[model samples]
Target: MTDPANPLVSTEWLEKNLATPDVRVVDATYYLPVEDGDARAEYEQEHIPEAVFFDIDAIKDDSNSLPHMLPSPEVFSSKVRKLGLGDGTRIVVYDRKGLMSAPRVWWMFRVFGHRDVYVLDGGLPKWKAEQRPLDDHPVLPEERHFTARFDTTRVRDLNKILGNIESKAEQLVDARSAGRFEGRDQEPWPGRQSGRIPGSYNVPYTNLIDSQSGCLKAPDALRRQFEDAGVDLQAPIVTSCGSGITAAALAMALDILGHRDVALYDGSWAEWGLSDKLPIEKGPEASASVSTER
Candidate 1:
């Protein structure tokens, strides 16, 4: 409880405030295609009381070729309004896999100008372990007016990264596994080659998380991880993962450190990896572009 207004909330805090009228809980669980798991099926099975399932894939821009790309302002507003999530609503998002995909939803809210959102620390696993109330039925949401003011500064696309790589104004942080970042492991997704965006640093999303409790690591530990990966805290950062899901975890970690200029590359490696034209780097020796420029 060091940061009461922290981006994350403990299950104890959530249980105490579960019945608050203005609080809306979201189950933002998402699994990779490799897992062959269904998020909706898991949410339907059991989730926090008063929680509604937020389908990460479904709520995204359908017109986008990449997976879970951010929707337009109108689309986001409409989808959130349907979920009864408004600008003023206090949103608490969680995932079944502890600290997995909940941060993505929290980041989405922030990008859409909803500042009062928090990710559930330890996520559903901690809540379940504590035997907190669980509801099998999804609650019917009353429609609410949600205004979405999309912030371009909080996101980066493929084209933006293309321009950024040359200027060396931003640090590219890859949150995928070391193997993936080193191009030694095959991607979970089909047909994509295994390699990281050139000049990107690897600090796997799992590094920021505690596996045992499903909670984020301490600030000092997170700082060490980023520093070890050669992330210069002073520079602006753009986070990327396999499909942009885990990248939010890195963004959340940056926010916790009070870094103001952190952004998520929504296209992430999903788009960049699949593209034949984009430059890809391999092995642990691959370094950030800023080094060469300096």
Candidate 2:
């Protein structure tokens, strides 16, 4: 079993620890185009009691044309401080689609040098299904001092990915479905092309999670999923998806599984697919070897 005290905290565990002075919960829901409804509007209606809404779009680099790129460290610090997340706060992020968008916030915190954050396994649906409390009231959190330390090593830009195509310095993992990765289906984001970066692997984020429970699969199942997708646990990896959202989901899964040398491609297919010059491959899946260790 993966540790509840690690990158994931159970709904039951959150229920028990939610009131702890240093514990803070965030509703980090970002609705995909297919899933209709305004995230902010839904959050305002009913949410986990005492949970603050962490808007994925709001906490991003507004200067970037892309959707929800990581914000500057100073900006991140300012935004989080307003949310009352300080040095000692243990953040637990949840979302409407189970652990989908919640892990992105989890990754964002880690990228900004805060490691005390965890994602609420199964998220709010599980909380509500278990009859947990909800509060529509807004919380006016007292501003606290937040320090942001940007870690460049955790992110990959387009230039770096282009270099990797030839160098093969790191493995690229696409979190999109096989159909999308293979260019059999169109991209959800308009104007973006389908297909994946050359030499990238495919491990849909959903493979590591249970749709019914909204929680990540057991640790062994997660390992198997990655292994089946040709992900080398021992090698350096960069995860990507459409517009960088699901890529964070892969990062969160890897983090919980205790893999270290992992980074996320901030541009992902959103940027790469839009470009005409960048070379992309569309074809058969790569061969993967499941590890015999353990």
Candidate 3:
């Protein structure tokens, strides 16, 4: 059985317990605008049996111009309730491109006080490579009561991040690629500047995952990745990425490493680079002390 505290579950565990009355699988596939991929259409083509699609774009804060920003508690509750995700359900989120977008959904659930949630380790790619069963039929789940208790501590706003620049109370850990973080590559969004938030450390999200298997690295390896990036594992950290997507992967990795004080910047570079008023830095990050303790 998968531990409740563990943020990830293997494909074997999911295939074994797929028929459990309380288990609910979610397909949270997302593609960047540059990729021009349609997540829903691909989900319609094939997915794990009994899996329902969780459209991050559709269930987001429509009022916000940014992509897939977290919705209000009421909105989240209503949308998830329609998916038959109630208090007792154990949700397992996965995505088409391995682990790319599933962790964000898992983080969203946790942010709204859903503790019985996990990401499917290795996601659909691993499942398919293992020759697991799949289905294309639509699933219309019965509506259920879902309560949302918004947890502010799991998320950080632009203003809070701006304040952190001065206080330095929490360390900023970025999950973007070295090229993008260093401003060598162009920003994905038009009119947005390339470069990272000042005083932030880089731990590219790719470093935390196994390139071949699409699964997250073991705890010790994950710890080393952060340590190599000069992250003090003992201190509070705010993870950020291109649009807050990969940031959740870092947050999940931190949680797995037993680092309790972790949060994610919801706007990420998408918002931070939108204006010239916000401060940004280029080239490699300045080094800092790494904590020896977990």
Candidate 4:
């Protein structure tokens, strides 16, 4: 049986419960522009049985110019309802590239107040490696009533991020690679500058996953990874990434470590770097202090 208390589930558990009436599987595969891949096209080729596709790009705040910002509660409810997700449904989200984008969808469900959602640890890669059953047929689930109660505490906006810079009330953590965070590499999005928020610390989301199994590390290891990256466990934290995708991974990791006061910057670097108006830092992390004045 899948542990509802845990944020993740093993492929073995999913394989056994693939046919559970109350369980719903979602393939939340997302690819960066740099990867030159299509997620839906992949789902058409092969995916977990009864797994519906959740397109982050399509189910977003269309009013915003930024990519994949959270949609309104009504919009989110409407979309997910059509996907057969609703009250009492045990949502199991997974992505093609292991833990990359699955956690983002998991976080989205939480933001909408769905407490029974979980990510499939190791994702499709690990499932394929083990030669598990797969299907190419599309699933059309009967529409269900998905109630969305917006939880503001789980999400942060550009204004909140800017305000925190001065107030230093919450620690900012960046999940982008060290190169991108340091401004040494080109950003995935065009016309955006490379760098990080002024005081955010780097804890590249990849560090939280196991290389061989493509699974998230144990709770103790995750704690050490964050501490080694200079994160203070007791403080409130806001996680950001290239476009708020992988940032959710950090938020999930923190949740796994039992940190309760974590929020995700929905705009993340995609919004912050688009304009030069925001202050940014271009090298290694400045210090352990929450405020790093530029």
Error (Å) of candidate 2 at residue 178 is 1.1
Worst window of 10 by summed lDDT in candidate 1: 285-294
Q: Evaluate residue 6 in candidate 1 and report its C-alpha lDDT on the 0 to 100 scale.
A: 79
After superposition, the stretches of candidate 2 with alpha carbons farther than 4 Å from their true spots are 1-5, 284-294
- Tens digits of lDDT, candidate 4, 1-294: 666568999999999998889999999999988897999999999999999999999999999999999999999999999999999899999999999999999999999999999999999999999999999997999999998989999999998998998899999999999999888899989889778888789999999999978999999999998899899999999999999999999999998888999999999988988886777778745433223343
**Relative to the unseen true structure, what is the C-alpha lDDT of residue 168 in candidate 4, on a scale of 0 to 100?**
94
Badly placed stretches (over 4 Å) of model 3 are 284-294
Encode model 2's per-residue lDDT on 16-100: one tens digit a residue.
8868888888989997776677999999999887888888889889899988899999999999999888797888899988978
Per-residue lDDT over 141-246 for candidate 3, one digit per residue giving the tens place of the 0 to 100 score: 9999998999999999999999998899999999999999888899887778788888899999889999878899999999999999999999999999999899
Output the lDDT of residue 177, model 2.
Answer: 94
**Ranking of all predicted structures according to lDDT, beginning with the best and ending with the worst:** 4, 3, 1, 2
The weakest ten consecutive residues by lDDT in model 3 span 285-294
Candidate 4 weakest lDDT stretch, 10 residues: 285-294
Against the true structure, whose lDDT is highest? 4
Residue 166, model 2, lDDT: 82
TM-score of each: 0.94, 0.93, 0.95, 0.96
For each candidate, C-alpha RMSD in Å? 3.4, 5.5, 4.8, 2.8
Q: Which stretches of candidate 1 lie over 4 Å from their true place?
A: 1-5, 284-294
